[model samples]
Target: MENQNLNKILSGEKLSIDEEMVPGTIHLVDLEGTLNVKKESGSQSNIILQPQPSSNPNDPLRWPKRKKLAQFSLLWFWAFMQAVAVNWSGPIWTLWTETFDCTYMQLNISSAICFIFLGIGCVFLQPTAMKMGRRFVYLGCTIIAIVSNIIGSQGNSVQVLYVVNLLSGFAAAPVDSLVEISTTDVFYQHERASYLAWFILALYAGSDLGPVACGYIVETLSWRWCYYIQIIIFGVLLIVQLFYMEDTTFERIDRDDLEDKIIQQMKSRETILSAVQSGQLSQERVNSDEKLNAIVSVNNSINTDDDDESVDSSIPMRTYWQKMRLVETEYNDSRSWLTIFYRPFFLISFPAVIWGGVVYGSQMMWLSLLATTQSEIYSLPPYNFTTPQVGLTNFGALIGSLFGMAYGGPFVDWITIKLSKRNNGILEPEFRLWTMIVPTIFNAAGLLAYGLGAAYEAHWFVSAGIGQWLLGFAMSSSGAICLTYSVDSYPKLASEGLVLMLFIRNCIGCGFTFAIQPWLTRNGLKVTTWLMFMLSIIINGSFVVLIKWGKDFRRATKNNYYKYSDPMFGELFKK
Candidate 1:
């Protein structure tokens, strides 16, 4: 029976399923631009749809395409800075250790703390964005970043550096979650994956560019130039935000349509008053007249023209300074404020959520290794490299990352569309996991090559060079795909999900950093790297485990966040 169903699905017949097994078909895309929603829902187009955009012109969903471009341009610039700040210390750890008389462990801990705080800060910042508004979070965080950098630039002690790191992490945390949330708020489902890939690129690109710039800065200038440069970047960002970032949260209750009804009521009340006074109407209607009078008195402030019910765009656009409000509505939902701190921990049960954390976190280990090990490898025998030369080595990883950024989105989207077509237009979240197969093979191959080459004392071009680039390509592509899949599968709770992913990713990264020196010293470079490579294979391969069990996990966790507590697994609880 299952075989027959598969054959029918392949032949383009609608794949049938039990309705109670899933929620509404809002996310299922069996065909491009068409969803396989039940005909009983009364969709005129015979398709299920979502993100059912509001008619409000002020709605971010309905904003002019030109405005969308302008808004995103500003957002990307700001987000790139946050990304750059997080990894600034990685390449400069050698300088930091010498300057502070601290050990490598202490320096690594300081860097990892910044990453950890990013997740910690997001837990509060995201819920605040949903409650108070994203505009305030974005602008406020940028301002904080500027102040943190200035203080960091002037700091003379190691303790001051630690405080600077903490403040930087806290201020930049909102960009990690809220920027992605803003993307979803503005774009449609079809465009989400591609746009998210762009976001990931801007974010991770910092990990690369920071090293490159810091390498040059530390060699030619003072170590403090790193902080100085960031201060300038963020200072400009703060000023631009004042003029460019508009409050996108909207409440479009159309009071203009209420104007006509209010006018007629007022006219009726005047007639009633006249009739009663002239003795043509009974005093019994006096009670009704009084009610009518009250209604008119309340609605007298409404302005209307003809029967135009559209929201008022007639008012002049707010001035640049006037548009700086973080949240325009007086509306408040207290529960939203709590989500930032609470939801990430609760979502640990979902397979999709686990994959997001594991895949992203594991791949980040390799990147962190590159940052942690670059100076040691290049500065020692076989290659006596200067600080600038050490920084240039990151170019290998950067080049590989550029490949992932350029091709990862299109590859994921193409495969998803193709898989959905073959499965009778049913677009399962699991379909995206297939993109991992290619990148996984590359990851294992690259790790083996790097380990073996390093162990055998092979040419730097082979082990440290090509191997690093391949690992980078694999990590960048896999991280992008995994994150996109998580968002695609469980977007209703993506804000919380992102924070959790960040925590898991940074912990794993920090874990790898701590283990790198110990493993190398005890087992030698080749053996330790090979062991890590083997472990990475297992982690990357776990995607299959998720694909098999993910649906059940989603059902268990599905819509649960909406109620703060809810049922799952469709009919499992029925007795």
Candidate 2:
């Protein structure tokens, strides 16, 4: 019966059990521990590596642990600095209004312009990254950051501030999209969530901690010093990246070719299982690493295309000079730059991607709320906190984000495996949604506590410590969950999906920043707080909808997914 099921799957039959399963629904868990496949070593021996590493020695997946870590750390730090440069102005906005002789609304518009460009930049830069190389985009953005900061440090007028923000937002755009894609390049699916959470933490740390540092800098020295210090740090970073950073972008077999190999391998594995069940071969032979490697080698030779001349064993590892090249021209994609730019807009049609956007965008709305209102609320009346004091309050959100990083990443990965085991080893993308309950509850309560606590003049801790902490937890965790869910549901389209999701998130954030002041002015803090609380429940609670029907949504899009996943999709589009 098990053999029959495997055969049916190989033949592309939609078995009853797989009616709602689609491209992303994977057989992830090895429940009985008898599966013959390549898997993670040590305690995670049963966990298979998704998109199993190619035999090519230079595959990022085949890189040494230390090498992968080095690449990740450099990218992570770049993302952190970009977030810091974009957000460092929030704490000093009051100082800026006085310094530039502008109104709070003018500063708010400047911030809004930053977000608009952030969204536009994601759409624009991603194509360049795809066409040139991620390394090219990363290096170019670093230069932009350095130049933007230099201008900012010397700026005397509001218009100069606008130019600074425009460049800063554009430079910061990759933090929202490409960093996540680069992460996926170096890590496998099982280990990705934790690092995705780390990416979120980097953003939060910079956005949260940058202002904390800005407060002290402005109070002691001057606002110009913030830009001056960033200029120095970015300069050092540019030099390090030029020598050390390796482009993760690599060309690999597409969806159909990978699926063919998987089908053939599964058939071979099933034959071995059948032999064991019939007492034709001993279990010890099945468990031997030598036996599995022999079988895998045979399968690879059988599956290799006739036209491909290069043997897997003959592929050489990349040299130090090759790795540090400014552009990965060897792996250049054949797709047109316009096609890459337009793909993300097309992905907005995917339900899971759209839902992921809403979930993540809601977090952005909350983040914008805190960013916009912190000074206004904390500086006046009950709190009457000084500049540095207001900046210090972000520490609560920072702490909350730390806990959120743990819960959203490794914890979710662990839970997904456990649940997959229970469901007969079939891992549905919807399994990722089950943990969304934690963030949903955290988000609603955090909004209420932060907003109502501030409205009623509660203790500083009530609003800052408890409320901001809860908000921070929900922001990071929920962002990770939804982003992971969308990517997992359409693994082939991960880059475009992320671009669309961030586009939506930044647009929402931009609009919220524009409206928050007016809304507060019209409704006062109490009403606005209640409305936002209700809004939080509606937005975050949406995980319930996805958890229940997400599989059906994936199933519905299967044909569309296959069509779009094609590497020649650009040519087809033109025709």
Candidate 2 is scored at a TM of: 0.90
In model 1, which runs have C-alpha deviations exceeding 4 angstroms?
1-18, 21-49, 250-322, 327-336, 556-575
Q: Summarize candidate 2's per-residue lDDT along 294-401 as a digit string, tens digits.
A: 443331232211112233768766788988888778776668788888888877679999998888988888888888888888888978888898898899899999
State every prediction's TM-score relative to the real structure. Answer: 0.77, 0.90
All models: lDDT? 0.66, 0.82
User: Between which residue pairs do clashes occur in model 1?
Assistant: 30-425, 30-426, 123-340
The TM-score, computed over Cα atoms with residue i paired to residue i, of candidate 1 is 0.77
Runs in model 2 deviating more than 4 A are 1-21, 33-36, 43-45, 254-311, 572-575
The number of the candidate with the highest TM-score is 2
| Count of residue pairs whose backbone atoms collide, per candidate | 3, 0
